[model samples]
Target: MRHRHQAAPQQAPWPHRVKRQHCRGLADEADVPPAISQDWRSFRAALVAGSRQARGGEQSESNQTLLHLQDPVLGREAVWAHSIPDAEQGGLLLATRQAPEVLMNDGLEQAVVFLASHGPEGSLGLLLNK
Candidate 1:
């Protein structure tokens, strides 16, 4: 007589990465569990908290990562938009006039770029709607 073979235990998938893949249109939610979703939310909150700390005095009650720049011309409320540090791969980058430096040599004012890569190594994106 021979013994039956046993399968190894399955490992849990990373909810954060899975959610990103979903946003990138690379994965479906059908296979995800509810617990994973909750875990993702917790993880996101932690990240947002860290972002707030990283920005030093800026604070936001909402989950959106925002940056407010003072108007140089009119000297009024200038621009309020998502911070560049929040950019991710496969995400869209909207060039803002308040940006510290010119985004591109061709002029990124009111331009959009597709983020191909984003990380500590730096970023690379494709210009769009030129």
Candidate 2:
């Protein structure tokens, strides 16, 4: 027995639509690679933990540093919050010894990246010490 399928009529004659639909159907949310998914989970957890720590009512420790200011009257010094901010535009990404050698293929190792844009969409950077 032979069965024949009929082609559906196109609302608009956009040839690329079929290809886009086919590609979208080939992968679903669960298709994300395990390593990337795990990394994302870890990053989210770190962010949540950092936020909770920042919101805690614990007073800053009395660590004296060059940036601290001393009050002669109260004999108290200001303690600045020691937190590394999240990545932002105009920030620099410095590669360290822990950088993988494979990054040398793109000259990213031992190099610095000047982030031009960083947002939910993605990040764009230019290599400074490449």
Candidate 3:
């Protein structure tokens, strides 16, 4: 059966509980697709052999541009860990691409979010689907 519903957690946080439901048959730490299940021994061997992929600029490079919020609430926004957002700590996060006049449909984008933590800057959470 498809695990589309959140399962009872064995000490999981609320968000992870939700993710567990979302990634159901697609992926998991110990669960592999049925097609690959039969050849897992070979798969494991190949994975070990090809591990530590060849390093290069293309493989090591990544970039991120912070999106700003227009009408951010005070003290509740997710800020990039390296900098302080105008929201301070608890405001809403808005992506630069989101148009203020656009009618958001079914939380289709990461245009808005709340900062759930302060130190170590945990995950960037968007309560769209939920």
Candidate 4:
């Protein structure tokens, strides 16, 4: 029941937040069936979608849920490096998040910090500036 967002801290750089744990989660989820885990492509799309959404976790998450798509291509780039090993990719630049604001935990009225997650409580993000 462990999650990648567990590494996310309220205050941490985006790079550090994108630890191996996140990649490992992505890799692990890739193996499971869609019934158990979300499809890799759909998951990535949700992240980059242009609307706020809840992250995949418990069924009853509050507004603290983390997910908001801004750009699918950018999220695709960012996720590719983590989900797929370099050996499989055969040498490519690391994918990075180019947008400033990312996933939101709640409605637009809620505060959204695109820096990190709630550390074991929710998702974390890499700094858009960094």
lDDT of each: 0.61, 0.60, 0.46, 0.39
Q: Once model 1 is optimally superposed onto the true structure by TM-score, how far is the C-alpha of residue 62 displaced, in angstroms?
A: 21
* Top candidate when judged by TM-score against the true structure: 1
Model 2 alpha-carbon drift over 4 Å, by segment? 1-85, 101-106
Off by over 4 Å in 4: 1-12, 19-27, 36-116, 120-130
Model 3 pairs whose backbones collide:
75-89, 75-90, 75-91, 76-89, 76-90, 76-91, 77-91
All candidates' TM-scores? 0.35, 0.33, 0.22, 0.18
For residues 76-118, what per-residue lDDT tens digits would candidate 4 score against the true structure?
4533222222122122232224322343322322232243334
Candidate 4 TM-score over all chains jointly: 0.18
Error of 3 at 52 (Å): 46
Off by over 4 Å in 3: 1-88, 98-110, 128-130
Question: RMSD of model 1, in Å?
Answer: 13.5
- Residue range with the least summed lDDT across 10 consecutive positions in model 4: 81-90
Residue 28, model 3, lDDT: 71
Candidate 1: regions farther than 4 A off: 1-31, 34-85, 104-106
RMSD of each: 13.5, 15.2, 17.2, 17.4
